[model samples]
Target chain A: MCNERQEQDPGKFRDQIRQGKWQKSTSGACPGYVQANLVILPREFALDFTIFCLRNPQPCPIIEILDPGNPIVQEAAPDADIRTDIPKYCIFKDSKLVEERTEITNLWRDDLVTYLIGCSYTFEEALVRGGVPVKNYLQQKDPGVYISSVMCRSAGVFWGPMVVTMRPIPGHLVARTVQITSRFPKAHGAPVHIGNGEPIGITHLEKVDFGEPPVIDRGDVPVFWGCGVTPQLAAMKSKVPFMITHKPCHMFITDIKIEEMAIS
Target chain B: MCNERQEQDPGKFRDQIRQGKWQKSTSGACPGYVQANLVILPREFALDFTIFCLRNPQPCPIIEILDPGNPIVQEAAPDADIRTDIPKYCIFKDSKLVEERTEITNLWRDDLVTYLIGCSYTFEEALVRGGVPVKNYLQQKDPGVYISSVMCRSAGVFWGPMVVTMRPIPGHLVARTVQITSRFPKAHGAPVHIGNGEPIGITHLEKVDFGEPPVIDRGDVPVFWGCGVTPQLAAMKSKVPFMITHKPCHMFITDIKIEEMAIS
Candidate 1:
């Protein structure tokens, strides 16, 4: 009943995650299937967070959202369990990571709301398919992420700067890369800032705020795309005492294709 | 302070609505302007509504969403006031129409969240421009609407059959019409049902749940697109004590161009 058997196939991944055998990062599971960035917050903060995502769509293109207190991601995965399906979980208490568990069966509450934001990995697949060279995409490394100075439109108790992931596309193919990824608005569609890293207030390229340091060649242009770190940062700023997120790289893979999210 | 300029201009129409003038239905205010469907609910119901929109995107493509209790719609109109800007408003109490006002200034609440969903008017303009004759578009009549038995995906307390708007396309131009309208995801994107009316559980063509009767022809095929009414229908079903929406034929016009909504 482990997720290992379900790894290659998304349908079986649902079964394995349901059976509690797949307590592993879903990074390599279901290669073509869309993996979602999850954030489950209580009712008290649900409205502000939903507004936050709707306002700042680039960093938070919501793939699917579940009803308040509903464990089943009805649209993303009809029978999938949000509390136990995510391979790993990050629980935050008033902006602090208080626990890291394999499942949130004990933490489930009646007013909790789940948001499944689109991951950049979905578009990373597009950049490769468009014939652009994505180094981290090929090596299976998380793109370098940073807490940028780009502020998100605030909603009620939620407010934070836009978190962006850095990927160095060469100057020649930068336009092509942009054209390709622009089609997937749900997956951080296009590059927010193209060239100047310092303008977005990135002090240093070599030192990343999150993920591994990106590779930059002589002609490589450092392109930044919105990251899943956005809602994480927003939740931390609001300091919602009861908030849970998927562990980095440990996502909730849905039974949807990446192209299904491409502006459709 | 009347909307004195060209009726087809969005900016001019918005300018008039903002200055405490032109508070009538926005149906004929701006001919080609993309009118939006408004939904204002308390924070308690926002996450569920947002989830409902995400699940049923065809019926609810979002234009811009304002934060809970926030009066400003920054992206759609940075200086626009949500409470007084729209021409007409409908107040709902326990799913019943309690009041119809020009402004909600007296009802301004700290817990209210505003959502602006895309309207069919965006694509109706595209269709008209493409030489596909839209009788309603020319006659200044309301687009035909109906509440079909086809159930929309539910979220929390929101659940109901989708309300669809019918457009009769000549047999030969049906495919072309679909291709053109398909470009605007912000405007409901594409048709869900075509050719047959009863399959989606519609019994009569003229006895619509809302709006005018379609002018179906001998060589025409009835095409159905998800209407913003679906969300309102869902909200009414929730029986929430308090909810606010735009009056029939009344909508909020955005500064964004209709062409800007077209997908490449």
Candidate 2:
């Protein structure tokens, strides 16, 4: 793949996606860079949904919003096109998953507004660098994602349960784990619940809604962070006609340093 | 008149306001507690206006937004009747200022939605305690508010220039001033500009547009923060057929503390 070259950048990665040269997930493709979850809606629904994100910040941390009728994520990655940058895209109509496309270039429209939400990639890097092992990265597997019973603060048409990603951490390293993750505010900040899954309305860790199920040993605790899937869940609940999102790990990569978000 | 003795306890303060015996500014009344700038609009305009506030953080940092047709501020202060608790309110009809009433109980409609915006009162108190006194407070006056060249990040039905409140400080204390104010993120955190006023399009400090003219001492610097007034101006610019805001200093005071906002 052309992505095997060191010179591969967002522009190159985007071009690869456009040319059908890359049809794989975007994780680990560009190290030390930022990735975002996409949410595109009609101009009418965009305002209320964006407000819902801003109101409940820990869950829906913004990356950059595209101007109405503009598909380019001008601020996140000016050189890249939102329609073709990602390896895959999900198209939703009336909040139901309609189709998964390799390229959304055909569906792009002037009335559509795009939103880039911060992904958990930055904090996962921070957790690993702090001498704590993330089994998801170590085993090259997806972290467990679950739909929790915690209802999000609603605004206008957007309202739904909070979706969280869980990572099993050894009890001894859990304190240090939260302290490190706490530094990156844009990347879901810190764990909402450290040891207790029942309190946050997660009945069983083994049966998650998305990604692979986590392996919990004797002394390990399941740590949950607010996930980017939150906005998707809300969008789904609203059943807004004609919505689009980045499929699975096919995230849009940005040039911002993750450490720039580490402020007290 | 009752405010002098009412300052001794929260019981008397709430009692008087509830009884309609008192209608005064809530600034110094609720010392450590957070105060909010209120904007009440009908259901028809709620979505668009809410989105506008979300897109523009500096001018319209929202503390809480009630659900459609919900008059009570359940988050900020539960059981608080917003229609009458506030000392004063301005009613706008079809984009024209109509009435400045003490209590909006008569105007309350089933379709009204309320937005509690973060007031500068919280941060200004912190600034005073930190030895960086806001000039207007010392002179026993209101803040120096101006309609600036800076435009708000627009949302549907809400698009206008940002209005800023200026606080003049000594050139050397500028950095310390920012550090002090940054802590209160809920209350319009940090200054937007620290230098010349001309760049932000403020032609004359003497001929002030909104509040008191800033008293610029020798060697002092003029610093500007995104004022809550910006959202008000933007809302006014939209000329929504129906709307309401607390008149000037007569704000909605709550039990929330500014320091309590530092969740991280």
Candidate 3:
């Protein structure tokens, strides 16, 4: 119920949201824990989407995948229900946003498969700790997301352009930022492109596609990382019959500590 | 084909196998290229097997997964056919080894799905390059394999104990060995257990389960790594109706270089 208590325990934080006691974006809560983007699809399309994630790991680094129709997460957060843990959920039908709900307990079905994907929060924290400038982090808002010209490998029915989140890093820190962020491959790993937006088809950095235009400092270089919003675009472009995702900025907090994701 | 020729071109090596001019194990051939363990299954069991690999990446690090019934590998090796590229293939029926064939073109099915998993050879090369002693490299044979008590996270109809390959490292070099091998996550990453193997259910270091017994010198400590042979064990234990895998020591050589698998 309190900020201090939620920061200390991922379980307690989920319980607060599950019971409807707290319903807000989980951006800064549970600081050290891993936060994931949720994607729920029917078993019919699970294989294609799973393969899609496997092929496009930079954009879709999967943290944990629950069994079909199973809502309880065992690895990331033990006993956390995928249906009610997040503050908000977006229901998509025929490639369109059909509903927004706080909880989907009534909509849970046996054939629905839940996939917890790594988001940028984990690596962005590492970047900030590594002395890199993250303008969106300082402003406490989401970064600018763009649909790049790079197309993801098609798997069965899932295919779309990769979506990336841009962060302005000083020219001197671009290499260091890549080193820091590359440690967490599960959290969208390293930058897919750096400095030049023209090659990746971003003609204008300020002409935003999804989020607000980023604030680029005088001597900073723009670094782009694969974004979790990619699946949403894939879903819409493919016109999937039914799908569910966590609303923007509201993520599923897992019990895995950010340190556990770092490689040697 | 000469040894020097095969070492330079992975595509030429596969062409030799396709032409039946070479039918030997792929060990020490194509030094810098990546070699993968092959697993082919029916589409009915592909999802479960794919989930099994995703859940247990330490033992089953997948390098590339092909589209269902499509044998041409696009990412790992362009224009390479999975059926005839490998030197040998093992056919399993109801958990029993039914045949060992040079190619599976006759047995290829439209519903079959192929999974190319990371083998320890990639990391072993790095270890040798980093000045670590590798007994199997000197002996020109596969390392000792054991079935451990640690069970893999099961998915659907697939479940089995983890299989690990044992390497004897001198006490002074164990830490360095971990560091060197941990860089290549695609190649079974790092050692699962070091020093004594009793905790992981390996009582006798000499009693081998799958391969030749290792050579442990004085002051040497047994280090265990997740082996690619794990999927074969799972297939046998789960009594999968029909499955295909590359024979022991014989592997599918991919075009990806060893350095590409390294992480920061």
Q: Pick the candidate with the highest DockQ.
A: 3
TM-score of 2: 0.85
Off by over 4 Å in 1: A1-6, A14-24, A170-172, B1-15, B18-23
Write down the C-alpha DockQ for each prediction.
Answer: 0.61, 0.28, 0.70
Report, to 2 decimal places, the DockQ of model 2.
0.28
**Can you tell me which runs of candidate 3 are displaced by over 4 Å?**
A1-7, B1-7
- Sorted on TM-score, best first, the list reads 3, 1, 2
Look at candidate 3 and tell me the lDDT of residue B141. 77
Worst 10 residues of 3 chain B by lDDT: B1-10
Candidate order by DockQ, decreasing, is 3, 1, 2
Tens digits of lDDT, candidate 2, A124-199: 8778878889988767677999988889988778999889999999989999988888776567777877777898
lDDT of 2 at A188: 78
lDDT of 3 at A122: 89
Model 3, residue A208: what's the lDDT? 79
lDDT tens per residue, model 2, B44-124? 777667657756766787788777677876777777888878888898887788989888887888888888998888888
What's the lDDT for all of these models? 0.83, 0.79, 0.89
B1-264 in candidate 1: lDDT tens per residue? 124553556665666666756776676556555779999998777777887887888998888778768878787767778888888899999999989998889898999988899998888888989888877777778778998888988877889998899988898888888888888988898898998899998878988878988887798889899999999989999888899999977788887778876765
The prediction achieving the highest lDDT against the true structure is 3
